[model samples]
Target: MLASLLAGLGLGFSLIVAIGAQNLFVLRQGIRREHVLAVVAVCTLSDLALIALGVSGIGLVLHGVPWLAIVVRVAGALFLIGYGLLAARRALRPAGETLAVTGPATDAASSASSGTLTATRRRAVVGTALALTWLNPHVYLDTVFLLGSVASSQGDGRWWFALGAGVASVVWFAALGYGARLLAPVLATPRAWRVLDAVIAVVMVTLGVVLAVGG
Candidate 1:
């Protein structure tokens, strides 16, 4: 069980820690501190459900439906491209920086609605997070097919393996979502934000273009 648990943990971290669209989005939300909890919840729960499905042998079901992945890939690519363009616009048209400025907001209600990580955009953030997670076929490949195959190979310890992977999910999301505040100081400048968003636009757009072209 220990060996199985370690194997699952190692694999889970290795697979998840890669620079993917989902991770980048999570990191962005973390930095923005907007709907961070909601974003984290959606992502973590989605992973848990997918991992459970995989360990429970839903991979067999997905294996028979190859077109499902293609559909998701196409949809995801379109969404990502649009989203990247939006980010690029934001980067170019810089909003007043919201980095660690220590002062009480003038109006609580206004700040809640207008600030970077405010409640007004909660719905949008969650929706984007879901699309980023579910629309990407790579997510299915990682959580459903790859994890399922490896977990099944663990014999009776597959559940234990799943458990370990689940733990990894929790740890990674918690650290990423909650731990991103550490960058507030460094990201306090509008210049920093421009750079970050510019990079994000490139990554998101590039990935979308590649996926669309079946690369």
Candidate 2:
């Protein structure tokens, strides 16, 4: 049981450590301070729900439906390409200035930047969450299908492995989104945003190409 738990943890962390669109979006939100809590909550909850669904035996359905993986892969590829293009476009455009804050700090910043922090385009938290959850086929493969299938293969202790995986998801998303605020100042600069946008674009494009090539 202990070995299974540790295995699940290692698997969960390994899959999530990649720099994907979802993580990039969360990092961007943390930098802006806009809807940070919403972003974190949505990400963590979505991950937990998916992990639970996967561990609860739904993963078998994915394996049974052979065409489903192809469809998800195609859809995920397109989404990544689109996101990459958009990020590249944003990188080329004049960067907008806005500050995201919470608690007293936000209120204080709002008062201070009343006229300076103009309204700019931002991704809706729920919309972003859905995109991250559904648009990426790799998510299904990693959490729902692959992880679930592996957990199910663990015989009597399958649930323990699943629980370990689910816990890791909660801990990771929370830490990445909230813990990241500590470096918000560094990420808030226009140069930093530009660099992040570029990196996001590159990562998305690279992933898209790989997926398209049957990865």
Candidate 3:
């Protein structure tokens, strides 16, 4: 059991720790200080649910219906390409002046107005989170196929391994969603936003194209 748990933890971390679309979105939200908690919950819970499904042998269904993977890949690629274009626009056009100038404008009333802004963007953020997590073929490949196959090999210890994987997912998203605030100072500049958005744009577009090509 202990070995299975450790194995799960290591595998889980290895799979999720990479800088992917989901993680990058969470980091951006954290830096923006907008809907961070909600984003974290959605990501972590989605991961746990997928891990559960994988442990319960959903991978067999996935493997049998290979078309499903292709469908997801196509959808994911389209979404990523669209999102990448949006990010590229942001990189080109930026939002406003630096935080140093607008810092004072964020008073109670402004904060309240920002609350409204956050509320409106919440839907978009949640939708993107879901798409990024569920639509990506790699997610199914990793969580359902790879993780499930390995867990099944553990026989009786598979559930323990699943639990460890779930725990790692939770911890990683929590840290990423909240800890990113530490970089808020650095991201206060428009140049910083431009750079971040530009990088995200490239990543999203690249991944989208790769998925489209079935790579």
lDDT of each: 0.71, 0.66, 0.73
| TM-score between model 1 and native | 0.61
Regarding lDDT, does 1 or 2 come out ahead?
Answer: 1
| TM-score for each predicted model, relative to the true structure | 0.61, 0.57, 0.62
Model 3 C-alpha lDDT per residue in residues 33-131, reported as the tens digit of each score: 678888999999999888888778644554577676565556656766776787789889987645431221245576675777656778888988889
Candidate 2, residues 24-133: lDDT per residue as tens digits?
Answer: 67766765566677777887788877788887765456457767656655665666667677777767773575445443234656646664342322345667767887
Question: How much is the lDDT of residue 99 in candidate 2?
Answer: 40
- Estimate candidate 1's alpha-carbon lDDT, on a 0 to 1 scale: 0.71
Candidate 1 lDDT trough over 10 residues, lowest sum: 97-106
Candidate 2 residue runs with Cα over 4 Å from true position: 58-123, 183-215
Alpha carbon deviation, residue 141, candidate 1 (Å): 0.6
- Best candidate, TM-score-wise? 3
The positional error of residue 15 in candidate 2, measured at the CA in angstroms, is: 0.7
